[model samples]
Target chain A: MKFLHTSDWHLGRQFHNVSLLDDQKVVLNQITAYLQDNKVDAVVIAGDIYDRSVPPTAAIELMNQFVETVCGELGVPIILIPGNHDGAERLGFASKQMKGAGLHILSNFADMVTPVIISSDIGPVAFYGMPYNDPELVRHHFKQSVSSHDDAHKLLCDEIKTHFNAEHKNVLISHCFVDGAIESESERPLSIGGSDRVSHEHFVDFDYVALGHLHQPQKKGEEYIRYSGSLMKYSFSEQHQKKGMTLVEFDEQGFRSATHIDLVAPHQMRIIEGELDTIIEQGKTDPNNEDYLLVRLMDKHAILNPMDKLRAVYPNVLHLEKPGMLIGMEQEMASAKLARSETDMFRDFFLEAQNSELSEEQDKAISDIIKQLSQQ
Target chain B: MKFLHTSDWHLGRQFHNVSLLDDQKVVLNQITAYLQDNKVDAVVIAGDIYDRSVPPTAAIELMNQFVETVCGELGVPIILIPGNHDGAERLGFASKQMKGAGLHILSNFADMVTPVIISSDIGPVAFYGMPYNDPELVRHHFKQSVSSHDDAHKLLCDEIKTHFNAEHKNVLISHCFVDGAIESESERPLSIGGSDRVSHEHFVDFDYVALGHLHQPQKKGEEYIRYSGSLMKYSFSEQHQKKGMTLVEFDEQGFRSATHIDLVAPHQMRIIEGELDTIIEQGKTDPNNEDYLLVRLMDKHAILNPMDKLRAVYPNVLHLEKPGMLIGMEQEMASAKLARSETDMFRDFFLEAQNSELSEEQDKAISDIIKQLSQQ
Candidate 1:
């Protein structure tokens, strides 16, 4: 069986307050074209289909169009699961009725026990979808002593394993932070104090484990375990990561080869640092000036309306910073000691208040008042 | 052909900060039971299926369950339109694909021109659904001169009339305030300055017009034009309004009798007025004390923690108002003139400052100060 593995679509995500719907549409269209050209059997979206629990109307419409084009128009069976960002109940609405249309969405914990068996040329492939689960809710639902995410996942996976048949090859699809996996700024922390991660060893029995929630495409200790990563670069931290989908070809015999396909994003994210004048000059001639940017200026002097000036050339600049300002601030803190003495402090106060050194007559008047106050 | 007409589900509505999901479930279950018992050919939801454009997770689950039970389980065709509260695009997401499962949702103006034909024992009943359309958007979409909501509805109805066949009996479903229709507090004003209302005469060609947006069940001048009201009492203003579904029986030639079926709500809304003590006494003895309540106290004296006291008996008291406080305020306003005189105002100020009436010594001192000031 050949299947395309993808995850973390985050359809309604905004990049630094800018809507990414158009960019997402471009990439989704690319994926749809790939699906049409390739001889793929099915598609498996691990999790994080939406950026939020309540997506905006435009996001909902985009997702509807994408799903319709992939599963409805392409006639490919797609299996989906809910990630930590999604509200499982909302994502799973009408899921049962939608399965007949080849869009299988598994969000309920009970549904995780039964595998969706799809027939292939070699034999049948049993696909198990485990959605993101809250440890507290899992504990209450199962009446178990699972206190952490790892324990809850293990318990859930063990229960699912019991229903697995040895006759057919099994594939487990999930959305979780696996132990020793790389993290990114965009992926929300599943729990406080880093106790949400589960061990990758739990899925050793499965032929392949397609994971999500880590926006980096890389294999774990085994080649069969991999993170399909996000559909696009959601943060500056993920700028170095190659965004793409993973394809796996397997059958009843067990393991097979997997291929990674890189997706071309509509726009790239870049970080640039230099003196304000130099950066402005560079921005004028830069080939990728339209890319989203985060700039840091090293000039000591303050630049007037820096953002407006930068945006004249780099229209997509999202953030601007001045590292030299912090250095100047530290120096100003050291010079503040001169204002600690009463007379010198008064002189400094006069200079600061008046935005200049006080005149000779004004200084004399201040000294006379100080003398009178001392006498009192 | 026989059909059940309903609207204003407001599935995710909150009353006095309390979730109405359970109450909505009760009413929807009643409607479901009614459909199973009756020989209805189809079901039409005029509009306002949700309280907000982005409904809560529970509301989405409730709506999905309702649609599944009606269309999937009961095998009945259901047609729905979007109301002013709903984001039309979001509500209509996947609607085109959903039609294959006997569920028709019309949200766009273009779709409103076509009718959803349902074959019945008598003949084919053509159901035209017009979702809530902003006057500006309607003007732009049709590229016509429609300034007010009436003009938009008239133009839309005229377009829909062009598609109507003389052979089939037509039913028009819409979500707009009809001219001269009575409204309740629960219904949101469709537009500013009441320009959102449309004339009922626009639907003269249709055999039956199922309208929504007004939470009062009443026929407009014509018996064929009606509003099904909301699924439940969403506010105290609707305390007297009987919430239910309208069942219509008709043929291809003309209209038949329509019946209003009252739905028994899990909790009724009530408003009570009396003295605090009397209200408490009544609350303790009233048979329907558990119902949601708005209490008005007539006691002339202040009551301590009146809401807490009332809740002990009537646990669901949502609001409390003191009518006697207004009368006391008026009396205080009349007496405030005594403080206008300089001597009396000084005395009152002294009394307030000391939290007690002025002493004879203080009064004499104030009089001496006033005499000295006047002479100066």
Candidate 2:
């Protein structure tokens, strides 16, 4: 079976108040284009299809367009699960209805046992989806003592094992924070008061574990257990990580080859660091000026409407970071203010109010008033 | 052709701060029950499936469930249009994908001309949907002088006519406010400044005109033209009108019979009017006290915690109206203040402040003080 493994779409997410719908659309079109040419048996979406429970209408429309082109038109079956970001009930709404159309959504705990078995050369590869569920839900479902995500996931895998056939190769699709996996600024924490970390050992029993919840494309203890990563760089922290999907090809022997296919965003996410003037001067001849940028200024002095000036050159500059420069500038100003005498401070204020410096006699009278106050 | 016509679901709507989801689910269950037993050729939702453009996640789930049950499990075709309340772009998502599964969402201006032809007993019933569109859309669509809704709709119908086959028995499923239809509080005004009303003559040529946008169920200029009404009573203004769907049966010639089937709600909505004590007394013995109620208090005197007291008996009381009693009390208080002498008013104030009556000397001193102040 050749499976296109991708996850953590985070549709409807806004970056620093700017809508990512246009960026998302461009990336999704690229995904659909790959599906159009590739003879992929199925597409496995690990989880986190949406950024939130209630996505905006445009995001919903984009998802619709993607599925219509991939599943409806391209005739590829998509296996999906709901991540912590998605509303399980909302995402799983028409699972049965859309199943016949090759959109298999494994969101409910009750139906987790029933796998989406697609026939491949390696025999039927059974796809199991374990959507991100809380410990409370896990406890209620299995009547087991589940205090953490680890306990919940272990119990879930145990249940799936009783139903899963040992003869067939199984691909476990899940969305959870596994131990040893890296974290990103974009991923919402699974739990607040308790640990949501699940051990990767529990999933290693399966032939392959397709995971989500982290944005970086990396493997677990074993190379077979992998996170295909998100479609785009969701945060500045993820600027260095190349976003992509995993295309897994298998034969009769099973686990033949898994390759990382890099997906490109129309506008690259970059952190441009330099003095404000240097960056602006570079932008004058810079070919990639339109890329989404976070400028880190090394300048010690304050600038007026720095963002406006930067945007005049680099139109897509999203954020301006001063780093330690602001604190250093503030300390310098504080010391300079302390070094000046109170009379000099008064003279400065007088100068500011009258648009001129105080006269020598006026300054002397202010000093005499200060001396008298000091005596009292 | 037999068509089960319904409209104005208004999902995600809240009545007087209380969610109507439970009520909506109850009525939807009833509709699905009817569909389960009857041979419904096609289900036509005229428009307004949701109460707002971006509905709550729960509302989206409900819509998903409804479509899955109707089009997926029941194997029936549903033709729907986006009304003024729905975001056309959001609702129209996956239209092409779900078309084969029998959920036809006619939301786009470009797709409005293309009819969903379902073969019925009489012939192919060409269902033409005209979603509630503003004048701007109409003007942009046709590049014509479409200044008002009337001009817009006339042009739209003209466009549909050009593509529509004359031989087919056409059913115009629209969400426009016809000139002669009755209005209700729940129905949103289609236009802000100009008239949204389209002439009945513009739609007279169709075999049967199924309309929405008006909450009250009634026939328009002709017998064939009708509003199926909303699924439930959305407002207290519709207290008297029986909420239901229209079942239109057709023959070889044209429309044979159009019957209105009444739908029942779990908790009946009612407006109770009387004094608070009497209503409470009635509620003491009333079995249907849990029904949603809007009480009109006729008590002239001030009643302490009247709503709290009424809710003790009728737990589902949503609103309590004082009506003319508050106005009357305010007027009485104003007149009583006018009639009272200055000294009398001061004595009353003194008594209120000290929780004791003012002495004759104190009252006389106050009067003397007031006279001195007036002279000054």
lDDT of each: 0.87, 0.87
Global CA lDDT of candidate 1, please?
A: 0.87
lDDT of 2 by residue, A63-162 (tens): 9888888998899998999999888877776567677788888888865889999987668999999988989999997888999999998999998988
lDDT of 1 by residue, A1-376 (tens): 7998999999889988999999999999989999989978788999998899887778888988877898789988889899988878877866766677777889988768778888888788889999888899889989999999889888988988999897788889999889898998888899989898899888888899999999999888799999999999999767788999998999657779788999878788878888878888988898889888888888776678988999998999998888986676777877797556555679988788889997899888888888788789
DockQ of 1: 0.34
Any idea what lDDT model 2 has?
A: 0.87
| Per-chain TM-score of candidate 1, chain B | 0.90
Pairs that collide in candidate 2 are none
Model 2 interface DockQ:
0.34
lDDT of 1 by residue, B267-373 (tens): 89989888888888877788988899998888876778999999999999998888886677777877797547667789878888888987899888988888888
What docking grade applies to model 1?
A: acceptable
**A164 in model 1: Cα distance from truth in Å?**
2.6
